[model samples]
Target: MEMNLDSVKVVGFDADDTLWVNETYFRETEERFAELLESFETKNKIDQELFKVEMQNLDLYGYGVKGFILSMIECALQLSNHTISNDTLQEILDVGKKMIAHPVELLSGVEEVLQKLENKYRLIVLTKGDLLDQERKLEKSGLSKYFHHVEVLSEKKEENYQNLLEHLEIDVNEFLMVGNSLKSDVIPILNIGAKAVHVPFHTTWAHELVSKEKEKSTNGYLKLESIKDILDYLKH
Candidate 1:
């Protein structure tokens, strides 16, 4: 891992898997969704189709549980050829409601790391999702007080990050982003001359996967087994 934390002033954390348990809930809900629509299609087929539906709807619904629920509904309709009953649709809606109401489970060592770095560097959340949903999670997390700012972005592209850095009055090299997804959290920030640390989550969304070749070419960023380990890299 090659890193120069000497210039880093603002340390931005990714909210989802980096700091808490998020993708697991989505995976569990997906399994339930597959079971619900088993009569229409096989679990494998349903899973693949749900991903396709999500990709197609990304532009329309953006990212979050609400968009996920809508994608599930669309997938159910298509797989059933529009024959899926209203009751099933209600069940899908309930799944989303339950997810939205799910408690915020912070990953291990999250607080300890935050406490160690809170005063040393400016901490901010750089996550992408529905604004309301993100805010709700932040409130439930009880980690909001440690952060200097919270940004719920619609997308995690180079331009979005550029704008954020500009607004914060920080140079690209002075900002470091920590997150789970390389495609979303690492690559874009790296592209804009910022530093990024990849803290891998066991279960990643398919959309967040990057090609091996692409990953190999994107050097200079640190890849740690856990978010807690970031303290070792920056604290030294």
Candidate 2:
């Protein structure tokens, strides 16, 4: 599906892997905890515990730093010899406050592409996470100016995307969804009849890397290697 650039009024972007480095920080924290718990449990066992806790918490807690914090606590308890108190749990949870990743480095030409397209499209950042944390990363990366609005939500389902477009009084066909995850970003937008662009990120979030791309839902979706490729497609 090709688009006339000027006709596209709203361009929604996903956070995390799409705009900056997200999963690496969580991976780093998990590795640190594995080392700390290595004596109590084998590395394989620790990884298994983390995966189980995280899977369980995704249902109870949804996704974000809070879920990650809970996963760490669960891992600690499952492998610990002594009883864990609330204070001990708080100690584990507090790590999230300092869990900010290194810096925001764009995937190749993300910033440049955003800069080029900002004037033509109504740029909106639709990301999910702790609001303050997302804001800090955006500010630190010097990427806040290009966007007109920033929305941080818990999930990016069909209802959420549809509501945003309805409120903006924009037709679904006139808007586009651009992001990394084929699950969260591509499939849902397409389900809503909006144009979806799949920009693959190198290191995706563990839960967000979907294995269902071949399904009929995303058959005609536009897939690009990176954000920069969107520019070339646009000029066509």
Q: Which number leads on lDDT?
A: 1
Worst 10 residues of 1 by lDDT: 227-236
- Candidate 1 to native Cα RMSD, angstroms: 1.1
lDDT of 2 by residue, 1-236 (tens): 55444456788889788888788778777777777676688888887888888888876777777678878887788788556567656656666656754567666787998888888778889888777778888898788999988888778899998887888787887788888888888888888988878888777766776665444455657788878888875532
lDDT of 1 by residue, 1-236 (tens): 66768888889999999989999999999999999999989999999999999999999999999999999999999999999999999999999999999999999999899999998999999998999999999999999989999999989999999998899898897899999999999999989999999999999999889999998898879999988888877862
Could you tell me every candidate's TM-score relative to the true structure?
0.97, 0.86
Question: At residue 145, what lDDT does model 2 achieve?
Answer: 94
- Model 2 worst lDDT run, 10 consecutive residues: 211-220
Assess candidate 1 and give its TM-score to the true structure: 0.97
